[model samples]
Target: MLADFESKHSLYFDFAGARPLQFVNPPQQLEVKAGQTARLLCLFTGSPPIVSCWIRNKEQIVDGPELWTENTDQSSSLVIAEAKPQHTGYYTIVVRDRKSSAQHTLTLSVIERPEPPASCPVISCVTASSLVLTWSGPCYDGGSAILGYAVELKEQGHTEAGDWREVTDLCTSTSYRVCAGLRHQGEYCFRVRAFNKVGASDPGPVSPVVRMEQRVSAKPQAGEAPKRPTCVTMDSSNKVKDHYIMQEKLGVGKFGQVFKLTHKVTGQVCAGKFYKGRRSKEREAARKEIELMNYLHHPKLVQCLAAYDHKPEMVMVMEFIAGGELFERIVDDNFEHTEPASVHYMQQILEGVAYMHEQSIIHLDLKPENIVCVDTTGTSIKIIDFGLAQRLDANTPLMVMQGTPEFVAPEVISYEPVCLATDMWSIGVICYILLSGESPFQGNSDTETLALVTAAQWEFDEESFDEITDEAKDFISCLLNKDTRRRMCCKEALAHPWMAAFDSEDLATTKCLSKEKMKRFLARQKWKKAGKAMLALKRMALLSKGDSCSSPTSPGEKSPLSPEAKHALKSLEQKMQGPPHFTQCLEDQTAVEGSSVSLSCHLTGYPDPEVVWLRGEEPLEESSAVQIEYEEDGRCNLVLAKVSMEDANVYTCRATNNHGETFCSAKLAVKQ
Candidate 1:
């Protein structure tokens, strides 16, 4: 029996020598913002059956949702999806084997901007010339010392509340006196925010509105009264009609109606977007958009001149882009569509995207319809429609199924965590269409298209890409990579060979791409738009009826579950059915490098869940070395052929069915 065991388990025991547990890579001190993800890795190589666990402080860590540990015979990783101040501490990875044991430790620091001032300001010594107010330090200094306070004032009944004027810079004193720019008899509200090395915190609660008044020079005698002011100035209002005169309607978009406007003072033509309603949510969304516009400043981005509370609607005034849509220019009979022109537009787009990314903003919805030309020449462009834009931070990964079907990244379709690379994938699809006049992953319907996107199934048509340059193809490939880590960032893309070729004045390298197919693509898009409009109208009619059976049953007609409706319904069902559960969980496997290994599992879930393989936090796509198979009996297998040392790690199978997600993981130990 001993001889048989030794012969059968020879893969685990090294006959050559007794290998000792040792650290191949060790963890190091790490620092991250409070709301960011933090990862600590500890790698070791030794004999088989190495046991490892993570320890925080003196307690062993048990893997869970917010914080989890992945371990193999040779490696261990502690992942904090969203690091909090409490998570800042020393962490240890303890490894043990039959013959040896080892451990590694590291420190993690989670910092954030200071919290708001402790309480609202106390009003005192109110006069026309100066207003003195005092405040306390923040309740929390965000893991750092509070440097000072910043004050902002907003005059009541003048401009928008968000338009607060800064009073002073880094006022070390808790109390501040506002004197400059003070208006006599003006009503104003003041707010304060604390600052630290991490950054400035959100403003504290606003103080009660204060009314400024003139002071009496001396005590009044019996029956004596102070004289009234001789003149009074009315506060300026920020009504849309007061600032601009609305002209002809420019266009209609997903969130609002765009109209041409003339500035009352300068007589300059601009565009105003009037939101559909003044509901609280809609108003809040509009304000968020305005805030982003105020924060981001770039030539390639549509500049928000001003915003006004237009009664039932909120109107945002922006620069008038008269060049029409980029698609229109491509199909225009008189317009020239050359490779150089495409390069020019892409460069500008990258510049805009880079600016947004630098600000940690992701434009979730980036498509041709959102890109507009500045003039008929089509040389200048601006990216618009930021309704879906979001700021990415350390708190947690953003998971949203948004963006146009054909242009969305695979991660978007799979409801995976969206990162900066999500926008890169859209850019890739746009580039593909621009050069070939084709939508690379378009299918017969949106659902089919989304499925294609999830699979990363796309190929260049021979006819359309015949004239496209190899450099351009490579650029698109890098952007469309299934793994976000492998995708090119805006900065890298700007320096790509394809983009670099156009850095010089030489337009000689430019090749003219035939726009004939582009015209047809544009026509198809218009038809689809008209169809969508009809569908929206039909939906409204059905909604008015309030009948569950109002769905059209005619052949070729859409069902009640429109693509958007289906997603919502699926979400609801997911909550009802719960997450996927593994009936037969995966088991650990050991294999030598350059050998084949297979891990299998059985999971049960409703609505037919799709599996996403992950090697640590990064997802794995099907390739020659990795093959994923789904059996009819609900069994799934991940086969790794010719596995390398890099393939050694914790592999996870995450099953998601739109509404719910479940995951199981096991380690793969590869021996050299």
Candidate 2:
């Protein structure tokens, strides 16, 4: 059983007055002429004294060449010599004691001469069919008030004789816009002069001649003409033809034609793309090419200098690479003797591909023809033809089949959802071609190539590639894995032992090659270790079961008991007892002096009981002195601080929350 009760009480306090205080009279306003001396003062009175200060703008005034200050029991003053506008604004006087402070505000105004207005220069000019005039204003002279300004303009090659227009109503703070109607297709020069109330200054130099073109309006007959559909024109005499200035024609492909062009201005060379305009789809393809070039920024990717959108014609300017495509270098030129350089170049290509994937950009087309050496040095490879590039956001679902048939992943060929893994698969095919100089999977026709991709059927003869390193083969195998989940990503492929060989010659010749072979042989061994780790985790989870097991706690482990655990235990115990009830306080007391005091008691029952507070033997109510604080779940607190003798008896606390109730007592002691 538990006893419950509540009570209330009142608390009060008083303080004794100290010694007599003093009053100070602060200055109302302090006026100081420029280059003159001025002093600020404050007066006060009191016994034993007080500290005073000269405060300016709520901050203490310090002693300097311009500002000198002194303080005493009678008054405090701050002296200022050669006071300027910076010395203007408000000042203050402050007096303070151990317990309180007094302050006053004083306005300090300094008289000085007005600053001169600065001269303004012409900032910019815009030419329309009409305007051949210019305007000017001031920057900031000496801050003097500007009354107004004057304007003037004259044609070029004309002597000191010309009409000078004067507009007196001009604001100094802003630039002036001058518009003078002039003949179209004619060049005219102009100059502007500025003036202030003080006087007019010299005129600024004349501006260069501005030639405005005449505006033409469309006639009814011209508007009736049919609008041309944007297309890629093959004729070399078009608008872009003059810009590109084809020097020589490169090899043509099913996709488009590339031509070498020399920029007339920079005298630099570039490649111009001229897509075949036989179909409407070709026009759409032209836009995709420009979009791809604008999004990709990498050293290894082809740089798009400019794109022309002439109706019924489109052209893309790209960096001219004389080294040609990798396919031509390896197959057409027979570069087996240059195998090392070729392999290194292929590694750079893979690096670019990896970077594209990391940026969530997919280069759907990956082939040797798209990979070209960008410079005569043959040190850089460029990935071109981004007509099929697509961005993949983090949440984008993998779907829709895309890319060339032969390089497409198995999922993509089967019309299933394909992700960046599909790109990796294409890169694997590219790597295979670069190392072996032969397509890993090819057919007599496009239909056959796609069939092979769908079936995931590709032939790789170790005998035919005996000269090829095992490390290279392992990397390709990881990327071409049939399962997307197990397939090696672009990042993982770049970190493979085969790619690592590019960094170390010794590793390339020995360790990486051996490691690749060992990996193939010990594939099952790694899986066995993974299996053991999983089993161990499962057994540990099963062994830890009961609530009172008192499992071995690791260092710094917090209490394993949860709030739900305590709730469950309390519920069970309360069922063993009966309905809950409140408890009464046996006694209560308060302290007259001190900072903190405590109240305590014991709670007993089948279920762990809670404690609450009360002033007297009645149910406790909340007030400033008595507080019913709570701690961890199911634990109640009765905290009383700043104890006076009034708080010196037993305090009652009733704790019950669906659990059986219990009463607790607290004894408080007040210190003198």
* lDDT string, candidate 2, 224-266, tens digits: 2111111111333335655546778875655578788876545
lDDT per residue (tens digit) for residues 1-672 in model 1: 433432342111122354556777565678888889999888887654456777764566777999998777678889999999989777866665544455666778788998887668666556776766666566567865566789999888867766898998668656677888788888888889888779999999888888788443222222222121111111124466766688999887667799998866667788888887568888787778876664355678987766667566788767788988898887777777777778888999998887777555789888898899988764889998787898776458897745667777777655568988999999999998998888988888666666677668888889988877788888898898887856888867998899865566466656667988887778878756534533433343344345325654543232122233333333333333445678888899899989999999986565456577778877766789888877644677889999999999999887766458788999999999
- What TM-score would candidate 1 get against the native? 0.50
List CA RMSD, all candidates.
20.4, 24.6
In candidate 2, stretches whose alpha carbon ends up further than 4 angstroms from where it belongs are 1-238, 253-256, 276-281, 331-343, 393-402, 506-672
Measured on C-alpha atoms, candidate 1 has an lDDT of: 0.73
Instruction: Give the whole-model CA lDDT for all candidates, comma-separated.
Output: 0.73, 0.54
All candidates: TM-score: 0.50, 0.39
* Candidate 2 residue-wise lDDT at 391: 63
